[model samples]
Target: MKKACKIYDEKTIGKFVDNELSSEKSKTISEHIETCPICDSITAKYNHLSNIFVQSTSKQLDKIDTDLLGQNVLEQIKREENNFFKKVFDYFSPKLYLKIASIVAIMIISLTYFQERLIRPLDIIGPSAIVNSVDGNVSSVMIFETKKSKHTIIWFSEA
Candidate 1:
């Protein structure tokens, strides 16, 4: 009499039929499936399901036109890029646009005036004065303003 199989579930038979099990285990399951009518029927069903799944998926992929889909995406991106600025401007009236332009002009004029009059150019602004005296050996004194902080610095050297 043939030895009875301990494993009879559909998962074990499916794994055997799909060649998912180790070589030795797959051989053993294959032998058992041949002898056991119930396991043989279950393996047949799993094979049918696997074949149907692969065929249906491939058919769906063949139905789509990849080149046409790619062109539609590219055209949409170009249309959005050309229309973005126009859309923002369309939200405002012509009178509002003039008002915004004038405000920006006034800000630029004020900044220019302050930069010319209040902020002196670095190259033109130098040491205000220098004092030097030799009491016994040697001594020198120089006074200048810091460029960034506008604080006065006095340098003295004696040798």
Candidate 2:
């Protein structure tokens, strides 16, 4: 005959059967079961009780009305669609659209004003000192030298 393990309380024994006991406690239980026949029998009984509970709960869930749940969801969707346009118009009324359009218009106008006032003026003034260089044979050099710069100009020819 197999040895019986020590009897633990329902809570502690439940945790032990679920493999949730701390390692040291699990080791103690293992050692006790090795020697005590009664405890081993109690552990086996608790394990059987736990397995039965799990199996019964699983079987109960198999009887739910999935088709009725699907029909209720379809009815809700149909009711929502009947008032779809009304819901949309309420969400995006003239006042709300006007507010959004005004914000976008203000952003565009501000950007245009800043570009004209600040960026255009800078473009007209242009950047600092310009340098021009020409490097080629005599004819190429002569053709390129016609370009002028107010700052330094350097030319190199390989005739």
Candidate 3:
């Protein structure tokens, strides 16, 4: 035997208004409402209320895009993360300091290892002397440049 028709609640009628009921249930409700004046009236009220609810919230509903909004938020987070990482990299970069220190160390090492070659030319001499005799005495004179001052000095001696 077929089961008796079930009375759907107002909420279910709201679902029917939204076309959410199964095909069989929707046909059954439609047939039942024709013979039930109370259900027919309730269904009408539910449809009216559902339409009003949709119309009232339609503007806000149209403005909402959860996917686009979530993507925008993720993009903002990525931008902020990139900025933070850039700041951190700038703070910790060692190339400049390392290059400067390396150059300075190389220069110091070269200077130390080639001190003599750097200070004075290999062609430079230490000193020179000239001697001459006048009357019965001999006189000698010597001249040279000091390493520190680069000035010539004359020494005179008589014997």
Candidate 4:
């Protein structure tokens, strides 16, 4: 006759019952149970207890009242809708848009006025004066040279 194997602790037996042990550990436990009658009895007891707990808990949950939960959710949605328009009006008021538009318009007008009054006049005045002076000087020199020279020969010299 084979000798009986030693019984494992409740924790190790629970892990084995729940299929949480590694393959090597499970094989060792199986080998021990094959030779030991006490470990086989403990494993059977754990299996019976787990089945009873699962069945009883599932039956208890099926008896709970779910009608009140649905009613409470509908009440909350109704209360939110009653205040929806007021919240939207507060967020998108006409006065806010008017204020923002006025600020943008003032900025655009000020920028346009500054560009026209300051930058444009300076640009026109500075370049026009320079070109006019240069043209006047060149015209005056040409008139002087023509009036002073009767048969003048201009020679090019390299400096």
Candidate 5:
């Protein structure tokens, strides 16, 4: 076992081994660690621990069943996709369909009622009034017809 460092702590030495310190600080620590045996041994220990961690994690990853993991992930994705469509279909329930159908039926009935009762024909089938005689002292006569009630206007203009 190496003695504890006086200037830099074990954490600082770990940072140096990981190259996480600033360039200037790293240079200073590197110089100090080269001279101090205690820091050097601690840095070696940190490096050994880091290497062991990398090797063990790599071995664990190599031992994993990647094909099984991929199959499970794909199955979950398929289930999620199916659930999305199921939710959309569930939103249009029987009651919602009945409401939609009722609204359409009401609209059709309202339009039929409006066409029959509210809208009037602009043209009349026959003459609205009979012109029996035009015997007058007028030079010109003008006749006008109203649209909705089919009323007639006889205007006599004298020269």
Candidate 6:
């Protein structure tokens, strides 16, 4: 047990030992610790505690098997990578392709039926050409329009 310090607390001394304080504060603490016996004893206690902690941590690290840890981590990574690629390959299987093809075929058939049954052809509208009346001597007259060129025709026959 160290005596209670008035000038600097134990936390300040601990920071000084850990080098956690700023340069100016650390210098001030160092000067105070040199002059004050109480601060000096507290700083020494902190330093001893830090040393003991470092020694115990070093022993713990030495006892651990780093090679086994590294090998286990690498094996886990490889297994995850293989599983990811397997899922991607499964998505593009032959059964999936067949299902996609069937869906596309159904869509094409539906669109074809809708167009033929529901929608009317452009040529079904009234003809652009107009004939007011036909005069005498015309036994038969026919009016029509061509498919591709859309040209109107007026055919007359006399008996």
- In terms of lDDT, model 4 sits at 0.69
Q: Per-residue alpha-carbon lDDT of model 6 for 1-159, expressed as tens digits?
A: 846877777887888888999999999998988899988887787778878999999999999888788899999878866897776766666797879978998988887788765444553465557778777688999988877545678899986
- Candidates 3 and 5 compared by TM-score, better number: 5
Poorest lDDT segment (10 consecutive residues) of candidate 4: 137-146
Each prediction's Cα lDDT score?
0.74, 0.68, 0.73, 0.69, 0.82, 0.81
Q: Where in model 4 is the C-alpha error above 4 Å?
A: 1-7, 74-159
Higher-ranked by TM-score: 1 or 5: 5
lDDT of 2 by residue, 57-128 (tens): 889888876878989999987887678796786677679797997899998888787986766656545333
TM-score per candidate: 0.41, 0.36, 0.33, 0.39, 0.47, 0.45
Per-residue C-alpha lDDT of model 1 across residues 49-157, encoded as one tens digit per residue: 9889999999999998897888999998788758968667766648878799789889888877787655556534655443464254438766667666456676667
Please, what are the lDDT tens digits per residue for candidate 3 over residues 1-159? 723335766677767777898999999888988997767887887778878988989978888877788889999878866897776765656898768778999999998788789745533454333334335354876656677545557666878
| Best model number under TM-score | 5
Superior by lDDT: candidate 2 or candidate 6: 6
Model 3, 150: alpha-carbon shift in Å?
72
Instruction: List clash counts for every candidate, in order.
Output: 0, 8, 0, 1, 0, 0
Off by over 4 Å in 2: 1-11, 65-68, 74-159
The lDDT ranking, best first, is 5, 6, 1, 3, 4, 2
Tally clashes: model 4: 1
Say which prediction, candidate 1 or candidate 6, comes out ahead on TM-score: 6
Best by lDDT: 5
Query: In angstroms, how far off is 62's CA in candidate 5?
Result: 0.6
The order of the candidates by TM-score, greatest first, is 5, 6, 1, 4, 2, 3
